[model samples]
Target: MRKELYVYHEGKPVQAVIRTYTERDFDGLIEVQRVSFPPPFPEELWWSKEQLTEHVVRFPEGALCAEVNGVLIGSMTGLIVSDEAVEEAHSWSAITDDGYIRNHDSTGHTLYVVDICVVPEFRKTGIGKWLMQTMYETVVQLKLNRLLGGGRMPGYHLHAGEATPEEYLERVLRGEWNDPVISFLLRCGRVPVGISEQYLEDEQSLNYAVLMEWRNPFNSSSL
Candidate 1:
């Protein structure tokens, strides 16, 4: 069954219906990805509507989409990679010269966040947070303890040895990195573990992605 999600900002409610992806939704998802990313992946890489429907039918929980007014504004897809699967892949690599898969499994689960994207015009309005919160809720419901993915943090190092924090704030306000989103995640207790040195090549930019584990304050075990 498909789930529904909603988020409110300053008393104005925004509806985000969470459901399995369809072919029609792929186009909108592609548009969102293109606008949100630099050197967007080729459109040909995306599955068609029929292919999306077929894939979802086979793996319903692996695909999810968020739509507002029947239009997809954002989406996220993930899979739980098990340690056994990782080991099997490694064994096969010995027969062939393929690269080894780095499988980091904790609590018997490794969440692979394939992608998460939000449209530009509707950004900074809590849509991204809502989508993530919804994802977390779903994870918890499935009895998972951790969520892993890449997120953008402020480019504080860009002004290395030159600008102060105040100057960095100015650059941030001028539509630099999405600082508020990073702040929200930090406030939610997400911690940074590492970064990708060459996450982006076209813009000569790198992504400071961190692996954040969800901690429940009220749970004694979590503390």
Candidate 2:
């Protein structure tokens, strides 16, 4: 694993530590998720710190974190998935078993990118991008078959009053409009498959999400 990462602040590069999650990182990752995800859902929908720990406990290799000067700032979590459910339409709660990571399957080849988050203070920095790239690298390195990267369309909230999820995704893909989250995800090689309603109760996206598939060509060629 790579140990050093650099992110920018006000156009200046700063050093950051990138590593896998340790038991001590539990509280920090939960805190990051809380601040990163803006909401429209009830308080009951939130994942408590203990719940987050369970994910790391079940699949430590699937979870990663970034820290700068010893302060935790970003994280990405995922779980292995297989069976017909991987191709069929599924909501975030369904895949995560309502946020418990109970669906994690080590025998599976598909890595379900459940969450990628960076604290607000670190926004606009390249840390989010790096975290994503790291996950992409992971998919390739692990020789996984594909990545089900569920990306939030936070910018969708701003335009939800004007268009449907399909319309918005079409516009974004066609270069007619831009969505901060989904748009970038596509650029990172995540291709939209469809939309999942109630996937997340994210106020920014109105409980809607764009499902994307990224296949690892290298893994297939060697098979």
Candidate 3:
């Protein structure tokens, strides 16, 4: 809700202060992302604190970060898109598979989760779940309709060109998927809707990825 809020687990008490991302937090966010991801995205792609501030000045509350002891440990980035925009993106073959494109026109709002990362040491301590709960609270407060992202097989290992979609699905269905991060999201609320075959193919890195959706439970009227 605010920077003053603290999430407690065990006796240690994790003081997670969430706020809108600023230029000053970019470097710290980048560091957190690098440590949290296996093949971290390039740091250069993130805008400087100044640029981010400018960007947020126009689109306020677009990005958020969680910090403990003044150090950023996790962050979530998302964008508000229209149903038309979603349809347009789906129209492109290289973007996503048709099975993954749900009918969002009936939905009121669409908040696409671009990224959500937490440092390894702080995970499984209830911090990740707290952060997600906080996100749901924030989304409801902001009147957003849904939360969406991609789920990966946690801790999954790729053996060169030997990987296959069927093997990945089998692993996930069998509950052998190893990626802790993705598993954490799944446990929190994200549901597997479809496979992100294009993303996996373009990256040439992972064997499987799934599109996930987390609808706003507060929307009683829609339900």
lDDT of 1 by residue, 101-151 (tens): 133233445444555567776666667666666666656665654555444
Model 1 reaches what TM-score against the true structure?
A: 0.62
Better of 2 and 3 by lDDT: 2
| lDDT digits (tens) for residues 1-223 of candidate 3 | 2655666646677667877777677789778867875455555544345544543453345467888889888876555556455543232223222212232232437666555677887766666676666667666776776766666553445532454655665565567764454567678887766665445432433545666677777876424
lDDT of 2 by residue, 1-223 (tens): 5579677887899998777887787778767766775564344555577677777789877788999988889888888888566677778878977667887887888888877778889987878878877777788888888888677888887787799999999989899888988877876778888888888767788888888877788886424
Comparing 2 and 3 on TM-score, the stronger one: 2
Query: TM-score-based ranking, best first?
Result: 2, 3, 1
Candidate 3 residues lying further than 4 Å off, grouped into runs, are: 1-11, 37-41, 45-51, 87-108, 154-167, 170-176, 200-207
> What is the Cα-based lDDT of residue 162 in candidate 3?
55
Lowest lDDT sum, 10 consecutive residues, model 3, at: 95-104
Ranking by lDDT: 2, 3, 1
Ranking 1 against 3 by lDDT, winner? 3
| Top-lDDT structure, candidate number | 2
Candidate 2 segments exceeding 4 Å error: 37-47, 157-162, 221-223
Clashing pairs in 1: 23-49
lDDT of each: 0.52, 0.80, 0.59
Give candidate 3's root-mean-square deviation (CA, Å): 5.7
Clashes of 1: 1
